[model samples]
Target: MNGTGRIQVARKVVGVGSVGTRAWVLLMDTLNGVEPLFLQAKEAQPSVLAEYCGRSQYANQGERVVTGQHLMQAQSDIFLGWTRARGDDGVDRDSYLRQLRDWKFSAPIEQMIPEGMTFYARMCGWTLARAHARSGDRVALAAYLGGSNAFDEAIADFAETYADQNERDYAAFQAAVDDGTAQATTEI
Candidate 1:
């Protein structure tokens, strides 16, 4: 929440993923049009990985998501919070809330130059390594990784297999849509 008296300047649904509903809200101080704040709220549900990894410790799914993000990210949004609201089914559902942006811009992944892509990939790898090191024994991980390309090759193979499986699943989904078994809305 804003410390000062900020009013809701605008609000809209964010057209992105199909996982759940997401909304963007803009707040502005009446006197300062240049310093508007934007926040995004997203509906949260039990993670699919829960089936194999066991249940989350947090009772609310929103809290679980926000907490996990806080743990994994080096820098987190200060406004991150969680709330529960009645869903369309008349049941309470959890939602994660946070600032949509904080002077940070995203690189257009599809249009990035090769050098930019390489930089982005390396940055992502470093960030992930930091997260892993924070959550696990750095020495043990280093030992496991070793000074070899074997692990890298194995990981690449796994990624290839995963991508192939994803493509096959997409094909099945397309077939279902064609046969009227499933209907997909692209407007989102």
Candidate 2:
């Protein structure tokens, strides 16, 4: 941002994954007031796996996000950073900030055919492998995996069980909504 323009900060309440997390967008005009630089800050909380996986070495969840991004990604956002802030509620929260070049993008899974879905699934597998290759101890992982398909089979089994549980959870939520135990709202 440059010149005499002002920055505006707005809360983004919709479409962000995992509802109830605080997300904010900051817009600052560059040069004149026409071109705007967009930065977004999202609340970072402790991992859901913390109970079994222990705690993150980084006390600040924001710093943990930044560090994990740097480790698992080849190229990070230009202004990727982190901070801990005490809000009006007097509670401190860790948040990761990044230049919001794009709001977000996703594949049109609804329109994909079986073949396209297979390809998409393979692509996702490769991407996850790449991230793990970058972050994990490759030698140790190779030693554990060896030249066998046992690890692959075990992983597939776990994934299937996980997906099954997700489906059950979703069904439960739907039942709750239908019975008036939970409320559903539409955006816009």
Candidate 3:
């Protein structure tokens, strides 16, 4: 699929209920039904198999926890114009994240995740990368580390889980194929 198509799918996945739901969809696509297994591991054997994972890594590295306050500040700064124009109520992180994720999937490319309070965490890495590449600023390294690339990498890692899920789906379908009782397929 094209980038836009992938983005649409991501948006749809994100819009479902909570962050856990979005993660589940991605996991289902990547790992089959092993989400339960992972969840179990997270609870039972968390330090072993589940270590170095997305949220875990972020928390362990202290990046997310430490920079979280700054991220909020940055987001507020970026969205100052929007807030002024809209006269919207103060931003809450959870609500902002949901709206931002939705906006990312729905907005035109140019308007996608503009630099601001809601997007500060997402943009920090890219901004840092740009600054470092241009001026060799060490401070930018910290920002780059906190940027969207980190989130992108985390999401991409889940593709393995999705692949596992796809394999399971295929296996189930293949069993039907072997049984000679498979339902007739219909095109969309």
TM-score of every candidate relative to the true structure: 0.63, 0.74, 0.22
Q: What is the descending lDDT order?
A: 2, 1, 3
Q: Residue 150 error for model 1, in Å?
A: 1.3
Regions of model 2 farther than 4 Å from truth: 1-4, 14-21, 46-59, 89-92, 101-104, 165-188
The lDDT for every candidate, in the order shown, is 0.79, 0.87, 0.38
Per-residue CA lDDT of candidate 3, range 1-188, in tens? Answer: 23222212122333333334222111112223332211100001112334555334442222332234344332422321111111135522211121232232333445556455447545656665454354445566566667557757776589778989999998999898878868646585
Instruction: Estimate, for each residue in 127-188, the C-alpha lDDT of model 1 and write its tens digit.
Output: 77799677667799899899999988997799899999999999999999999999998999
In model 3, the worst 10-residue window by lDDT is: 37-46
Error of 2 at 158 (Å): 2.4
**Candidate 2 residue pairs that clash:** none
Worst 10 residues of 2 by lDDT: 12-21
Rank all candidate structures by their TM-score, best first, as comma-separated numbers: 2, 1, 3
> After TM-score superposition, what is the CA distance of residue 108 in candidate 3 from its true location, in Å?
18
Native-to-model Cα distance after best TM-score fit, residue 64 in candidate 1, in Å: 0.8
Q: What is the alpha-carbon lDDT of model 3 when measured against the actual structure?
A: 0.38
